[model samples]
Target: MLTNRQLQILQVIVDDFVTSAQPVGSRQISKKDWITFSPATIRNEMADLEELGFLEKTHTSSGRVPSEKGYRFYVDHLLQPQIIQADEANQIQSVFKQQMIEMEQLIRESANILSELTTYTTILLGPDVQQHKVKKFQIVPLTEQSAVAIIVTDNGHVENRLLTLPNGFSPSDIEKMVNILNDRLTGVPLQELHLKLEVEALEILKQHVKTADTVIQSLLNVSTGQKEGKIYYGGKTNMLNQPEFHDLNKIRMLMDLMDKESQLQSLFKPKDKGIQIRIGSENNHMAMENCSVITAPFSVGEEQYGAIAIIGPTRMDYKRVVTLLDMMRNGLSRALTKP
Candidate 1:
């Protein structure tokens, strides 16, 4: 455990490094407003910190910078949660009040606002549908052998799929199948629908004709396949301005990762509560080794919906980022619950 004075010096070093993007020296800390120690004493403490693996020296002459372990320790122990300033809170509330729209639009706008506020790339994943109940389904015939099926969930999410009818199946036959699907599938969660199909409907369809087996398989695939939730990304160019991404190779890898929606979705897998911080090397993606991700999950009613995340270099201001994300989550929750 570090002494109280040593902790103060470490905090000053981190704060200075974050602001200036430069390693902090003992002489600099001694001259700062908060320090009363002499330069030699501070240098001794910095050397001890380096030996303990909390700080690292990038060059022979340069001072110290916080390591990943240091950052994790600071966030978990030393950092205090900052309250959102009055003006910032009012601005966020104003945005939520002015643009009351559908859930999809709201989530997209929230991503835009968060990126603008934090000046870092932001990603918002639309709500997970595992718990969603199918409220309605509509089948529209596009051609004699093809039709469009639109499924609406209880949470205002709409999923559409195009299905090919069996050869020689009439439009009337398609309508009959649609009616049966709606009657049997409405108000049921998606996982249960697959079971119902295999147990009760598959035999009946098979008895109709041997071709019914293929039709049943196609229907089940359309219903239970990937949901393809919407992903909203903003502030792509903002990453270029960060110091850690000055390397072209790092920038290229990061851009590629950003383009992969599946990877971003995996990064923010749901947690219980509060914002989650993933630091360098802890992130599974090689491209994010120098980056940090702060994410918070938001919900609609009782269901955990989706997450909003801020992406920045590992030296990101956690206190400010955490406060901003907390406010964003609250605003999103309230907007979603609004009548």
Candidate 2:
């Protein structure tokens, strides 16, 4: 619904604000070499854009800043696909070059690199472990009172938990409990392991093991822990450097949100398989009203696995972040799915 000239002016305002964190005046837009309009004509366009809700005039300055709607429109309509520079592409490639690296290490390294490149907070949600079925279960006794409960998933990820053996719980009871877990839980997805254990395995354990309740509780703790993808963070404190985050109250809310797993999980949940951008209030959380989040889902082959997200002020460098995220998403998918 916008004229070409109006769109051109809006893009300029967004680009300038993103770089300088200041309201952009018509004089500034007119100074661009590509802009053919005079300052008066550009100011008319700016006024029109503001009336259309794409720009907001600040109380302290005559210059204009892009509203949240402006940023959305710019990203959806005016943003151009940016080609990753060779050196930056090489930097991303370096994350995958190591041989025999653990999955956690790869994801952790990717998060760090993305944060370093963007200079923003980066979050990587690891592959969903619930989709992986149980591959093996073992309980190794450490002493008469304690043992290590190990759960190995089909993806080769291992989880270990220390369980305190119940008083008078015998070696025979331990052996029986391990047998029941392997029999009823092998090949079961981690998400369903807890319910399956309670419904089908608990009765079997009770018939054979004297301390079935205690044993089931310990196993449930381990299975429940693996129900969600692990979260990895890089540059968690980078947001403190952004000018918008200088407010103490805002910083406190954001920091609290980061420490909470459920909140962080919700932030990364993807609406679709492609890149998703939530600017300001679109996030529906007050703590994020001044922030923008960009998410890119990564997959292994055709199965969507997990996602990566970057959080920054609403004046984010959308073109650069989007391009880098897509490149990294493709690279992560290839690295994960490679045979």
lDDT of each: 0.79, 0.88
Q: CA shift at 141, candidate 1, in angstroms?
A: 14
Q: What is the lDDT of residue 245 in candidate 2?
A: 94
TM-score of 2: 0.81
Q: So what's the TM-score on candidate 1?
A: 0.76
The candidate maximizing TM-score is: 2
Tens-place lDDT digits, model 1, residues 1-339: 998988998888888888888999988898988688899999999999989988989975569999998888888878876777788777667667865365677777788777877889988887756556777777777887777777776666566777776788766665666666677777887656678677876776565454556556656764565564568887877899998899999999999998888888788655666788999998888999999999888876575577888899989988888888889898888776554
Q: What is the Cα-based lDDT of residue 3 in candidate 2?
A: 98
- Model 2 worst lDDT window (10 residues): 219-228
- What lDDT does model 2 reach? 0.88
What local lDDT score does residue 198 receive in model 1, on the 0 to 100 scale? 77
Top-scoring candidate (lDDT): 2
